[model samples]
Target: MKVQKFIASNMIEAMKKIRQELGENAVILNSKQISTARMFGLLKKKQIEVIAAVEPQPKMKDVRVKEKRKPLSRTEKKPNVRNQSLTSSVYPADEKELNNQIEELKDMVQKLSEHSSPDEYKYYPIPVQTFLDHLRKQGINGMIMGEINAKLLNDWRSENREKTEQEVYQSGFQHLKELLAGVEYGGSQFQKKFINLVGPTGVGKTTTLAKMAAQAVLEKRKKIAFITTDTYRIAAIEQLKTYSSILNVPVEVVYKREDFQKAIKKFTDYDLVFIDTAGRNYRELQYIEELKKVIDFSQDIETFLTLSLTMKEGDLADIIQSFDDIKVDQFIFTKLDETATYGSMINLIFRNRIGVAYVTDGQDVPDDIQKASAETIVKRLLKGLGV
Candidate 1:
């Protein structure tokens, strides 16, 4: 057997080196991540070490012919069917070992393909790689992941030694905080009299509006009323009415611009007026036009684009783009507890240059909602990542 060891900056390079030196038939005996001392031992650079071996070819001179023997009878070959069945039911130990090795190699290749730029992440420490994997599983986009990789690599190179999982998480948190620095967060400041909630169908806009209104009435001790333009759904109107009844706040249902104007006039004496727009297919431009006609956007109003975290990233992006004509002040991410992945929220915020006002976890009136902030968002995103 020909045995050789190969070392490279990543698994791909290591596999290439092994194949080139030991041929395709070579078997991987062992592989592991290793750190090499660098910069006069002040820092360490990560590398992959792989050991492989290939069976040696037999020499022609060593070949010898065997004497011919009589063939076995048919009866002899047909015997022991029970033994054959028993053997077929159980895999041989050697074959099982080979299958395990193949699976391991498959997993390595899968990990390589997961990265958008594998070369860029080649030298990342184990903890950093694990952190990046966690981010990927959380549905973070490739562009954001690439940016994060660069930041992590820069930090890893500057440090004298390897970073622990917790240290990597802290670094990620700090970088995310920096990314979200300029965007506005937190619940309404009450600076605007009319707080309008708008989004596509089934995003829970009416419920979210009720939550925000509940907070204002119960916590802030502010007078608020509901002006719902979601007249398309009788249930939505009733749902708002139910919430309004509980809060002892009045609700005005509007079907047209004149009715909306009258509702605005009626709520003029109130501290805040929550406008719940009809949730329709945002892909249709007419819904937005209808919304414009109903709601006085020119008034002292803050428009919030409510979204469900359970939706796909592509769908969320499309919904955000569909509202390009309207002036969206911030976002309200709903159903936070419905999905384990939260990266879509970060992706949208980073791409659209918008911030979150609130995140709703459940159906509870106000308890499920929380005011969004950079710290709170980053912590939620990095949850269960060894933090």
Candidate 2:
């Protein structure tokens, strides 16, 4: 028998290596996941390790019997049992070892199948499985789900006792809070002179902008003004004008870089100026360039990339990439009430490392918006899970 070990980044590659070395008759003895240290042990990467073995083929002469025994008649005496034993004694050790190896492999495969089966989560405690099901229903990404699963499993094992559903849910909530600890949160600080909202078409940028402006006027008591470059849609301009009229603030319409500069000069005395850019197919580089031509990005502006929670995560990621050249200070996720899946919001914040300023649930100016915090976001994600 021949035996060898192989390791690769994943199971598929490890299987390939084993097949190349051990051929089709090879048997997989065992397989496991491992982590390899990298960069002086500061980092670790996950890898797969597999063990395989194959028996060597016998020579032609050995495979051919030296003599053939004739069948004995029922009446004739049977061959002595000792003769039978002697015929099998040539490779007794090899046969015994192979049987032992096969038994061990069978045990390992049984365990692996039990752990990886479609109903595998059944092995976990009921409370843990319930929480995991909630995460899946929320559409959480696999990476984050893996981390959460590890944390929950570790806690469950450490306790060595079944925990209540609420206890397990709290554990998951705390883990999520820890993951978001390093990120910044809360709404605008009103420190910058210019507040800019940018995003693709029909993402509620205008309403969100109006909400923030209304908050400034009603709560912060700051002298705010609106500078709109959304000339492509006359209704957008009228919408801002409507909000400005209600808030009793001035609105400026700028069409060119010069107009933007002039508007900035006009609003220099105000406490803050909120600029609303046109909603175009930002996926096109030309639209982004046109935005550059119409807005003075060099000014003291804190840009907020507004996104709707109803959009798919891939589209949100692409919109974020389009604004890579622009300095986006934070995000303002709109229409939170429109979608039940909030995992994409958490995914985006974790991926981009950009914090969320506010999440709006309704179109009511300033009333439906709330400043985001790590606790609030996590609570919202874990809401109704235990029930």
Question: lDDT tens digits, residues 6-125, model 2?
Answer: 987654456668778988667677666677999999998766677878867656456446435569998999766676664354444666687677677757755644533223243356
lDDT of each: 0.82, 0.82
Candidate 1 versus the native: TM-score?
A: 0.72
TM-score (C-alpha) between model 2 and the true structure: 0.72
User: Model 1, range 1-387, lDDT digits (tens) per residue?
Assistant: 467888887655676787778877666667676789999999988876888777555443333233233488876654465666532334445655766666676567556546453433433567787788788878888888877876786677667788877888899889988887898999999999999999999988988998899889888899999998888899999999999999999999998999988998888889999998999988778878888988888899899999999888898888888899889999999988899888988889989999999999999888889999988887888887745
| Cα lDDT, model 2, residue 348 | 89
The alpha-carbon root-mean-square deviation between model 1 and the true structure, to one decimal in Å, is 8.3
Worst 10 residues of 2 by lDDT: 114-123
> Residue 86: error of model 2 in Å?
37
Model 2 segments more than 4 A misplaced? 1-122
Candidate 2 whole-model C-alpha lDDT, 0 to 1: 0.82
Q: Between which residue pairs do clashes occur in model 1?
A: none
